[model samples]
Target chain A: MTISDNDDGGGTTVVAGTTGRLTQWSTKRNRWIDAIGISAAIAVALDVYLGIWVTPPDKVQGNLVRLLYIHPAIATVALYVAFPLAALSSALWLWRRTRSPFFDRLAVASVETGIFFIALTIVTGSLWGRPVWGVYWTWDATLTTTALLLLEFLGYIAIRKSTADPERRARRSAIVALVAFVDVPLIQSTMVWWKTLHQKATVLLGSSSQIHGIMAMTFALSFLAFGLLCLWMIINRYRIEAIREELEARRMEDAINDRIAESNIRVDDLLAANTAPANTVRSDI
Target chain B: MAPFALLVLILFAFALGPDRTPLINATPGLFWVAVLFSTMFAIQRSFSLEATEGLHDSIILAGIDPAGFFIGKLLAIGAELGVLEILTAAGIIILYGAHVTSMLVLLFSCVLGTIGLSAAGTMYGALVSGMRLRETLLPLLFLPVASPVLIAGTRSWQAGLAGEHISASPWMWILVAFAVLYICVGVVLYGPMEDM
Candidate 1:
């Protein structure tokens, strides 16, 4: 039951391209990351302030409407932003000319961050549903699709870990990610067609369903904060992934070198044995 | 796979307490579960067959169109599952006293559901075939995607058996849509996965 080991011709194409260098972050880059982090924090704080202090409570649902402030942003990031970024990166990796480890790293980073936001969406959605829908859980199409997407991401991450080699792992992960991406449209469409407890896209087409004027403003601010956080998290994750890949490549190189050394020692012994016959020619004379 | 499914059915009957009424009532869901797990293993075997050292390479060397190869494997899996479905159906009839109220819709649901499941299963099967966690990963990746099939299949059966005003809900359509979508995905995505 080995997974994808059926990719039979995976016969190692060992390209000795990179020397397994770790990711290097410059001071300016670090400062930029710091600024992004601070901006995300302030945005989230401001979003919280605007939602709790400034924005008027829902005329109908009172304080329970607070979930609206963060839920939509997280859900949008997880489903809309992260999922598409991964699919695009995977596509770029497969497009031959644009094939680079950078895209693969970016894909991984976005997917990892997407996983976090997905968890947040599910938890918050469930909490919000408890009061509004009476049941915390429903087999709603959108919820089901989101959960399936989470599983797909987990499967994607799992494949990356199972393959020990770096390049092969990246390629395999990219391929699987693309294969899984086929579901994204199916899920979104299913949510649209199937009438369920979970509502469809509210703010996408300017449908003034739940998000009205002031709520829309707060939603925009929250998206700014959370979107920045998503980007910052992806950058952090990408850097860490680059370092990990470098370490893996180094370990692979060390193993290859050790094997070469062992084989060379064996060749030396064989040569010495061949010369032994000449050294013993005096006995024959 | 058949024997395992049978065992699962046995377990279900036992867990529901040897009561006929309870088993009968639970047969719809349990039947789909048995079919799902059994067909999952068949799909896994279809993959493992290709993965036997050198076979996959030879097929690629022989220049087999991935679409034909995929359809062949899918049909093979579907055939095995058809047999399992019969056995599960018999188990339901005998053990749970399940009766088909709308034979036509039941057949439609079963066929479309099987196709949808096989389509998605084949894709995932190719993805996780020789993985270290093949068993675990197969179910983890497969079950979620295939849940729609299970839901639609079960609902179709439930709607058929109810014999109410509606002949059957549009679940058969959902199953058809699922089958078409995944088969198309396989056609598009599977060729590159060979390089994975």
Candidate 2:
């Protein structure tokens, strides 16, 4: 009954027996993340109130412009999501060399959030653009390249899902994420390199005169809010996936145990039959 | 030297522009066409060089960084592209009545756009390098990725030729973004692709 070579200094570790301590740890992490997420949402609502009610409307765009709460915030989130994904993918591939369920979950969540915001950015951009650029879509550098950026991400996820084996899928997806991550900044500069129909940057962000007062505050708060939400989603997805893995491990263990018990019973029956036949020979004699 | 000869031939094409609209108006399309065709020629040589020389397996066994591998290939492609761009610039000045207003902007855009092209081309090259239908897949993959650079480059160059408000500053940043994207995708993906 004893399993040899136990690694935890031969100490009895109950959590390892069947409880799945790591999965439980992930669940705890998710709860904390969710709490933070709720607070962040509240902060966003407060910031939106401040932005629309308190902050003065742009002299050019006017009161129809409070959409700034979401516009730049979404773009910022999009940038934030890709870099970490690249790092994680690279780390998992180079170091772990195994399909880490944790990293896989993180990558999926990040990309999903990225796609969501990108959609928001595109939609808000169009809504903002229609009032500003007078058209829904233009072949402008900013819009065109951004669309291409999203397509590249989509392609990454597509490849991951299309692959059948989880290990191979993880390895391959990690590669795609890393490569796509490197391209983020390069693609961004293309609009600047060549003449594009898009307008130049008005806000250098954090430059004193570029943005200030209520506008600045709202931007900061909304960014925090969106960032928190992204974090929450990642943590939640990671925990859920960890639980799934735990269940899978349990199922496999149960299956092996059932096979062992069945084989043991067969051995017992054979021994009983052999002993009984030996004893029965005396009665026949 | 072979590349140089190819460069000279491309220069001759620029020189013998259609006797209709001055080369300036027509040069944008021609310039990109030259870039595209030249890039295509170079792309064909990408994996074939290693396969023919039998060095492909050696590189794999040596365990060089996949990103490094990507850069190595891109540099070769970039050098070829650089020569083509320089020739195109010369043609723009000599044959077309164009002035090199901001050499910095022109050079920057050319470099960044080339980076985008090479990054994407190298990735696709790697993907299909071992495939039976590589030649067919390469163009299919390269064209869609290169389209942005073509549209942007042609528009940028046309603006420069027309002596319009050619602010390369904005577009330069855009090209930078494009380059970053391609590099990221290639670097992250190409190593595992080596196995494939």
Candidate 3:
């Protein structure tokens, strides 16, 4: 629970809990993330109960409408929200005053979670599309853009893996995230206009139309549940990322120590090749 | 880059196997593909050039604005790709026997599309430039992210070549949007990418 409980070469492990804030503030922030997660889980469970059994079947689509509970929730969180957070955190990380390892880790964590949900969105959309659109995949704009977004972020995560140094990796990944976020709007706009079997926005902004009645309530609750679920996933991922960073810093310290020992022996060998005592020679035996 | 684009076209010609009419029909898409791969080659070269000999470090140390460096590279790649575009366009015209009906639309598409492609390719090339697997990794990373460009570029080309039934303004706007978006992102984020 303490900040310096385990220190490895000043890891300065950045989390809301470890950013040199007062312990009470840190503790409160940690609790806040967890609380959101707990509430998200509860909301989602309730949503499942209401969406599956309570909400009436759509007058046209029948019980097949149950996909509504999960699909839009996952899509909105993955595509629209996660990327923006990643981009914002990345921008923050690049600034001097606002920069922190917390933002770096948060950016990657958001993108990683975003990746997971985008993949889910595609899978769920396909599952929903199979019965509705008569095909598992289509050239439809939303579907294509979603697929593209997933691939674009796969690159982001790939760049993250391409390096071991956290700061360097974070910088590279941040650039990728920023570029991806900017591209996404154009991607969606172009793709949607390109060709689409998908419907236009129904629940979120920019749609002139609105859904009403029990269906509306279920959808709203599901959106909240899913949004919270995204929050929970990212918060947990960010914490794990912080711990992983600490482990990496510790590993690096061990490597530095090993290097020092090796160099010391080399220096001694160069200095004592002719004068060193036989018994005092650095012993491998 | 021109050689790579020529090679792609050569390969396409062989794959399509001497159907002049079909080659002509496929000219628009094949042309963009060549330009796409060419842009990829130019980006990899531009970044690799910068990554060597402590050039990048010196730039940072000398306190040259990273944004200007990015813009400089962006324009360099854009200019180089511009030449490659003319060569590829000629290759498409002569090889595919293409008949251009809308010359203005075609040139607009080429100009705007290359700018977008170069901006995106430059940023991504920088992203992977220092890696051991950059050669193998750059395409794997950049191509998917560049899908919008690919899609939009193709549509614009299509509108230019066979756009008799439709106007090219919308697709051109897409090209404009992509170019502007990536440039803005590149200018802003170049500092972070170049900081190290």
Candidate 4:
């Protein structure tokens, strides 16, 4: 760390360079990203060939019900991934001072991607609801919680963007993320705890019988696919962010160099003028 | 933190289950009552300890991460809430005849709800730590943030007691989500809150 002194009491300290652990971590994350992509492909294959074609369709919902495999899977992935992203980003903000900018950006990416999948879930859910329940949307516990969860994510993103000070922004946004986590379970329980219109759990803990062999396989594959999608998105988002950060650092270095060069030129001109005056005095003497 | 929490627990016991008889229709109300008092007390006392006796700077200087400080405080609050919850639950079960089909879900929901309250309240406390009317502003900010937790916990408890096909999964998930989100916000904003 380099400590720059100010005449005032405030001392501005910057960690001079990235640490080894960070580099190793980033590399590991990249590898994980690659792994996630491969896993996603496999999941996609399983879901398509097995879930859509190999598995028999529901007698009631018919062929149009193929979307079920993807919808809930995506929704589950969205919820699962959002919590970690928000948490890691927030932790990065508080524990380490230098990582705030990157973490904050990562938090934004997670929120954006979460919103994408959540919106997909809601839209698909509504579509399913329409055919099954004869309604496009209902204020059921599940739906209500989902909407609120989306809003909370939006709030996190909005607050992050609204703040100008990087430190303040990071801290405040992290606070928002922590606060919003309270809703995750509340949203989940709202459906079952209350008399909501949403269906009960097709999958409950300690109850494997609820899931059939083929449907279970499809659900598991769909879950894997969606998980892969989330991992891919997070990795890509992190990479783009790393590049942007590198560029920003380079830009800062360039600006500093320019300033130093300009100052050097000014000093040279002043010395030349002083030498010229001294030469004239010597010549006159 | 301990003293403040104890006070809150005491108040919760008195308010909901007075003289060993739980209030009528108290199953749902008990959860909210506990949450309200606990949050109120926790948020108020959260920063007060740091604010008083010039200890906040010592905490900062100890290299104890600000977010860690918040979490520590929240944990204290949660502990206090846990004790209060146990007492309240006992009273409700004995006095109000509240059923406990799935003790796991009920207790888990209680834990989650308290965590959510404490997590969000910690941030609000820090945000208002330096304000002139911090005590007043803390609830204003915290209550709105924690409304969802209260509603979810209350509803979950009610359904659990009623044994009317209560799906405990959603409430647990929401509580987990709330804890994650609250921790994120607290970590990110601690720098600014500390500066203030």
- lDDT of candidates 1 onward, in order: 0.78, 0.66, 0.78, 0.67
Model 2, span A76-127: residue lDDT tens:
7776664466447545754545545566767766776777778788988888
Note each model's CA RMSD in angstroms. Answer: 8.3, 10.6, 5.1, 12.4
Q: Each candidate's DockQ score against the native complex? A: 0.40, 0.16, 0.65, 0.13
TM-score of every candidate:
0.84, 0.59, 0.84, 0.54
Select the stronger candidate by DockQ from 3 and 4.
Answer: 3
Q: Give the alpha carbon lDDT tens digit for every residue of B35-101 in model 2.
A: 7666766777877888788798888889889889899999899898888788766755775556666
What is candidate 3's lDDT per residue for A1-285, written digit by digit as tens? 232544432334443333333322333346678789889989999888988888888778888888988898888898778988999998888777998888998898899999999899999889888888799999988888888888888888777887887778877877777777777778888887789779866566555644567777888898899898898888778767766665565456555655676677777879877444444332422
Q: Write the per-residue lDDT of candidate 4 for residues B1-196, one digit (tens) a residue.
A: 3354445445656676564445546557655765566667766765677678799888778988777877888898878777867766776566555567767667778888888778777777776565565565555456546766777787677666666444656666677777777777667666557774
| Clashes by residue pair, model 3 | none
Scoring model 3 with DockQ, what do you get?
A: 0.65
Question: What stretches of model 4 exceed 4 Å from their correct place?
Answer: A1-16, A19-32, A88-112, A164-166, A186-195, A205-213, A266-285, B1-192
Q: Pick the candidate with the highest DockQ.
A: 3
Instruction: Report the error of model 2 at residue B32, Å.
Output: 5.8
Docking quality category of candidate 2 according to DockQ thresholds: incorrect
Best by lDDT: 3
Where is model 1 more than 4 Å wrong at Cα? A1-32, A188-195, A199-216, A257-285, B164-169
lDDT for model 2, on a 0 to 1 scale? Answer: 0.66
